[model samples]
Target: MSCKRLAIIGAGSSGLVTLKHALDRLPGWEIVCFEKGGDTVGCWGNPYPGFISTSTKFTTQFSCYRKWDCEADPASRAKREDFFRGAEYGHYLKDFSGAFGLEKNIRLHATVDRITKVEEGWKLWMGEGTEVFNHVIVCTGLAERPRKVKTHLPVLRSMDELPEGKGIVVVGGGESAADIAHRLAAPELGNRVYLSLKTGIRVSPRYHPIRGVPSDFLRNRLMLSIHRGLRNAIGQKFVEARIRHREKFERAFHANPEGHAKDEAINARRKQWDARLTAAAKDNLFNVFHTKSDEFLDDVAEGRISIIGPPKGDGFREFSEFDGEGIIEIEPDIVCPMIGYTSGLEDLTDGELRVRDFHLGCLHVRHADMFLVGFARPIIGNVPTISEMQAKLVISLIAGNLERPRDLKARHEQERERVEREFPLLNTEALLPVEMFPYCDQLASMLDILPTVRKVGLRRWWKIMRAPASTLHYLDDDYDADAVDSQRVHSPPLITGLLVLIKLIDLVYRRMRRRASSRGSVCPG
Candidate 1:
């Protein structure tokens, strides 16, 4: 194949990985990665105050380029931590670039003002001059603009602006909101932290309820293979029980039982919050995606943070609506709205996450030369891993190693229908939410890298199925086998046995259902 010039926008985790794959796959290709920021990692380099990743270090890392624990190299052990701070993660990305010699290809403090499609290819307008590339990959992530909500209080644009030791109401029930609340409501801070939820959100603890392992450890091939409806239904019950148990445990162990009147006051306050939360989330509990947080729920139970609904009849008309009665007695000095972000991919996407337009959430249906990476939000997993998978798909397409479908529209419709059928409860509107395992598997299947039982053997396949859904498992090379396995959090034998039994029963039921349908379809003799 002839050489091609590739322009990658935004040298974040996504862009860096894309460049890595491009170097590996498209060896002779001319690649230039543009980073508008001064540093390599985009937002992570300048993370919010006291920002810690919700994802564990094991799950948040890039598939191919990641640090490993080595006895000889003590510095590599940082990768074994439970979670990564923003600065630590940024350093890791920088280290990755340096390790791969990718920095020379990356243009820091450079911006691509405009991208236009021409007969030759895509024309990128930079500050100095315009350049045309055979292929362009937009790795600009979702956090383009902070989502704003109508409120009367003094609104904080970002958590970086939040002051210590003040009455604060953090809006939104998302990860950012939860983390901010957890941090600001530290018992030592003496800050009255109140979390306002317009809609009830599902919260996943850092540790699994059953296995006491990282909750993400449960996000394996076997677990994801089960229907999302079933998995979520079971998950909802477990999470509720865990929360209840935490509440009881905290009250018994952490609280002062000597003062009966004081204890009643605390209980009443928590009960009020619980009632408000239960009412707000009444019907749509399963529909909401889980946000991983270790301290937020515990803080709420301990009376460090108060949970409330939107102010009554104050905000915009359509906002103040849920199952609960809106309004609260406490008036916050400052309000931080962590509602989410706009995609900022409007030029090509038209401010919409069209799965049809972006094939497999990477390739452009109309223009194969144009690709979008890191645009998907996984229901459970992180984005960097997903971006790596997408980058591989893009590289495969560009190299002509992967064949494009003759009918893309039909394929898109089929995929859309399949997603709707499998994940009936998902709210697929803005961020193109995907089941990470299935999505990655789809891309891996196209790449012909998906591990099969026959290829890997039954024992290895079982181990892969049981382990955390790391991207390494799909690779033919067992280079990172020890690194990945070292971090494995095994479930109890009884629980594992039960899970296998359930899976077998589900498989049998599916087979019987298919046979019955096939029999019914045949006309009687």
Candidate 2:
């Protein structure tokens, strides 16, 4: 390690992108990037077969160079040019490393044994040798550590490693659980699968079952804003069924009930299939977890995967009771828990959330020289783009292109409030599960690279405040040096005006009701 040289830990998507951007921005600075694994794809490097981008390809690429065709033929099973399998995506990250000349700067197979803050800088050690760099960017990734199971039940990195044809119970429902269930249920494996999940969390489909559109294409925040305002204006009675929170959270299911499916028999079968979900979740078909994969539900319906969980009633054990023989009583020969995500963490204390000291988005609040990237869960969101945005901010801070006060009192106060609010849901310092668009926008604003696309023009406002969307909609924005100016960003949206009016009306009504009650007269309905 040398002075003025930047230390980049991990050659994943976030790490590689940060390295490329830093090199271009800081010509005179020295850099050394490290990867424990020999390859550069990070999580996608050794992903299971047939694994593809769960979201639109656009959402999974760096902003300046996301050339993947997002509008490709979704129906093609032959692996079209738009969405890609995991192997191809890994190759894409490798290409980025080569094209950006990052390979020469990277030292593969070098694992840092531990890191400590020293007087010179951050000290990263491998065995007896140690190196210190002026600045450190950690891209170890959110899911670097699989959520641990408390008991000593059998565990594995992938479900494919499960004993063939053995009964399996997958615990803690999430994308990982779905991945395992799908693999086990495939015709070749034919292993019985069971899923355990918490009720009331959402299970979103990759695509709209009826529209045949990928879920990524339709989860627009703008759509949510407009729908909310319109639904509020139209009265709750009229929109109650349509505007339910469950459907609102999951756009794919919303589209399914609105139109006709090409295959009538398939649709009927799907409804019959949905009944199982309603029964298992114990809260109607739509009331279960707000984020589940449709493929997982498909397995549940076809009986390929049996589900064991507590419904919306009493009697559901948090996970499962361990038997007296030091084994989980579940009969599955293999038991896997698809739990939470963390960054380079050993384990989580059942309910422990530490507030990380970070300011201006991803920079260390106290250790300003330290930058963190890819440390948050993109839970049902985007990681590549989010990581890229954070990368931009880190480089900007280091290069002196971004300026702010050293004491971030206001910002720190807000961070405290945010942690207090979000602690109930997730208990990790670096891996906050923020919604995609707002998170990106917040970071982009901090970096002073406000894309004009988010400005308050009628079109932009419509896109921002009124569209059902995935973060993919915000892709293709230029993040070059010329693009990083606040003047280029437009003012607030039209919804602000409507919100002001609504607030006034609400205030006036409250005053009238108070006055009537004070006078001992009933307020008019």
Candidate 3:
């Protein structure tokens, strides 16, 4: 095969995996990966103090690389049940590049300012001058730049600069705001936090419904199918059931002999949430982004962190009249705005960014060779694993090993519609916030790597069915199948039985529907 030149922007998890896969599939190809940051890991390259990842090691690690033994690496400060610290995950990414020999292709502290189309391929203008490549993959991540507000109350962008023993107001209803508020309000920190939510926020436990197992265990294929099948008809009820399951687990875990003293605060918060939801009937549970934090809400209940706005459909009040010195009347020592981020792809694409611009949020619809990887955010599941799958798909498309969709526009529209229906609050057009399970399976099916019952045998398939949705479940070119199986966690007896039953029913229903459709048609079921 002739040598092909490829340029990958951003050396985070997405970029490293893309480089590794490219080296493997298109050996001898000239690949250049540019990282604006001084390090290899993109997201965790520079993290704030006391930063912990929402994702667990089991689910977050790329399929090609396994074995994140925190016991061996005490610096990580993580256990089997604990989530990875930002630096620890960054270390893992660095190790990943080393393991796959991806460092040689990576250029650190190299920023690509502009990418333009050329007769041969694409032109990237970086600080080191111009470079041309046959293909360009933009893996800069979902948030190109952090969203900021016009506030003058000692705004702090990075949490690393957060001060203690002072009054703080954290803006935004997302995970960052919740986590930061929780951190600052801890008794040792001696800081009173006021969380200002623009509208309501969804909160889920880090681990609940089952102890020792991440709640993401509920995102198995069976649950995903059930959710997909039922969401359109009764999305509200489906979401309610999910909440109830989490609540049941939480109540069980927090039940204590102190006359449920801890329960008082939680119940108070629940009432506040219920009243707010009742006031705004349009903003159902489905639309809001669920913030996964174990102690954020607890802090709110215990009077450590007070909630502002998010009551009766009102958002955080604007601070239009700040004192001359940029001091607010409330006089908070610091104001942290975790509002959101903007998709920094306006220069790359024409008009506003939309789902129709890319197929599977990886391959660009207009340019066959161009791809936008790691922009899709999963509602539940690991992002690095998803990015790994995207890397495989991109290589397959470039190698002509996989066929592009004939109706690419129509497929994009369908996906957009699905995301809108399921996650209404999420803006459907721009950045992709996916359902995770079905999305991963969609990519896996395209690569013909989905772990079907026949492929892994019925026994192994059953184990997978009852376990957390690990990207490792899908067989990989690297890593032993038995080792992957050993890492997979089987749910408790009741949860396992329920999931198995649901899967069996879904299978039978699918078979019946196929049979009914094929009764008179010439096509096979």
Which candidate number has the best lDDT?
Answer: 1
Pairs with backbone N, CA or C atoms under 3 Å apart (clashes), candidate 1:
none
Q: Model 1's lDDT to the true fold? A: 0.69
**Looking at candidate 3, what is the lDDT of residue 89?**
81
Candidate 3 residue runs with Cα over 4 Å from true position: 68-81, 144-148, 229-288, 310-334, 348-356, 484-489, 500-525
Model 3 per-residue lDDT tens digits across residues 419-498 = 66766666545578776777888898988888888898887776676666677777658636766456445355766576
Q: Candidate 1's residue-wise lDDT over 1-525, tens digit each?
A: 156899999999999999998888887788999989888876765477566677767677776765532111223223325667658888888888988899989898888877887897888887779888998899987773446656676666553655777888777776767777888887777888877766776656565444344566666777777655456666566556555564553354332112112455655554444444543553462235566864676577677887676655544222233444553566567777776655566654344334336766777767878888998877778899899889888887888888876787678766666655545554343356677888898888888888788866786777788877778777633235555455453555655676788687767756666687688962111
Q: Which stretches of candidate 1 lie over 4 Å from their true place?
A: 1-3, 68-80, 187-189, 244-287, 315-323, 347-356, 417-429, 476-489, 508-525
lDDT of 3: 0.67
Model 1 is weakest, by summed lDDT over 10 consecutive residues, at 69-78
TM-score per candidate? 0.83, 0.74, 0.81
Native-to-model Cα distance after best TM-score fit, residue 72 in candidate 1, in Å: 20
Order of models, best TM-score first: 1, 3, 2
Error of 3 at 439 (Å): 0.4
Q: What overall lDDT goes with each candidate model?
A: 0.69, 0.59, 0.67
Model 2, span 1-525: residue lDDT tens: 333889998898889989988898888788989988888888775487667656666557766665653343544523433455758778878878878788988999988767777897778887789888898887777763456655444665563465678777666655666677777787678687767655422445555532344556444443333322232343233223322333443354323333334465544554554444433433322231235355665565566776555322222223332211222233456666666655552222122212265553366666777777877555456678788878877888788888855567677767656654544455545556555676776776676544354453455544343333333333233533222221111112443454445556666666776789789895322
Model 3 error, position 506 (Å): 5.9
lDDT of 3 at 250: 45
